[model samples]
Target: MKKCISFLTVCLLMAKLTTAQIIPSFEFGVKGGMNLSRFSHTATFATENRAGYLGGIYARAGGLGFNFQPELYITSKSVTVNSGSTQNKATFTSIDLPLLLGTKIGAFGVGGRFYTGPLVSFAINKDQNVGDALGNALHLNYKDQNLAWTFGAGLDLKKVSIDFRYEYGLTKQPYNNGNDETRINLFNLTLGYRLFSL
Candidate 1:
């Protein structure tokens, strides 16, 4: 009985050591996707699906089956409204920062990412029916980054990876329409590539 107990203890220790020896593979990649969005309070207006794109470098570090990935990129979002013969549109160009937490099961993977930790925008430009059309050198305010979240799944095929993520905004656009507050909610599908092998 004593010998059996000693053998079991050694086996347990070996398992722990094996787990500790596992290391994560780090890689770089790019991501792009589509955006479908609308104001939360503006139900009278139909939601618009726009072609939003995000392409930038990303670094992933992880061990076992968990990874933390952060990325920087440019994002374009827009909303359109049609009231009979008139058409109205709102477009926003902002730099986006996404921090993703990824998990792997065998060769398949899943992730949850949240963007909006912090950002500085120059507004770049704005086109509104109620305001002036093009003489505006609108600068984006740097008060805070827009809050957003995303969920997606992908496959880590050796050194290459492709992912699809949906992003949703959690704050207003700092502009008000009379008694109505304009908020940002985007549904995005992003595809990314891993550059370096881990």
Candidate 2:
């Protein structure tokens, strides 16, 4: 309940900022790319790295060396687990909201920007089939909501942009046992094109 309230407060603050805004330029775009993800598990669980996908749309509003970016995107995380002779894989999906405040620096031809912000994510779906080789499947329950931080840099040239980012999960995911937990962490590279500029 506290987390939900905090999120609401952040939203209200952003709304207030928007009402007083005077941005010189606004650009809307689509981005998609591959992500390499892994789980940082406690001593009770062993896990490996796996690959996933991420894609989303974003709007950037600002100019004159600064920008405010807000995005709504879908992200995926995967991990590999080994238990005895059985190697299992699990993937989870979530919706991510990122609010970024940063500055851009470049010349007449291209622009480069670095941004850092908080990410609020909600897990929507997951696919896990652990312990299947042992004749039964194990169930894992994780929290639906999570908080994270992202920092990255990107370059914009013409209508194309590319960026690299790292996200560290602040909230840990817990299994049914409660004592066992894992935090999702990953690095992502994305390529985007401006579909429209407003």
Model 1 / residue 118 / CA error / Å: 10
Q: Candidate 1 clashing pairs?
A: 24-62, 28-195, 29-193, 30-192, 32-190, 33-189, 121-140, 122-139, 122-140, 123-140
Tens digits of per-residue lDDT, candidate 2, 13-132, equal 666444423447788999988788777765646778788988889888886557898876777788886656777677777767777888776543377889999877766643422222
Best model per TM-score: 2
CA-RMSD of model 1 = 7.9
Task: For residues 111-139, write the lDDT of model 1, one tens digit per residue.
Answer: 33332232222233443321221112123
Candidate 1: misplaced stretches above 4 Å? 1-21, 41-44, 83-85, 108-142, 174-179
TM-score of 2: 0.73
Candidate 1, residue 120: lDDT:
28
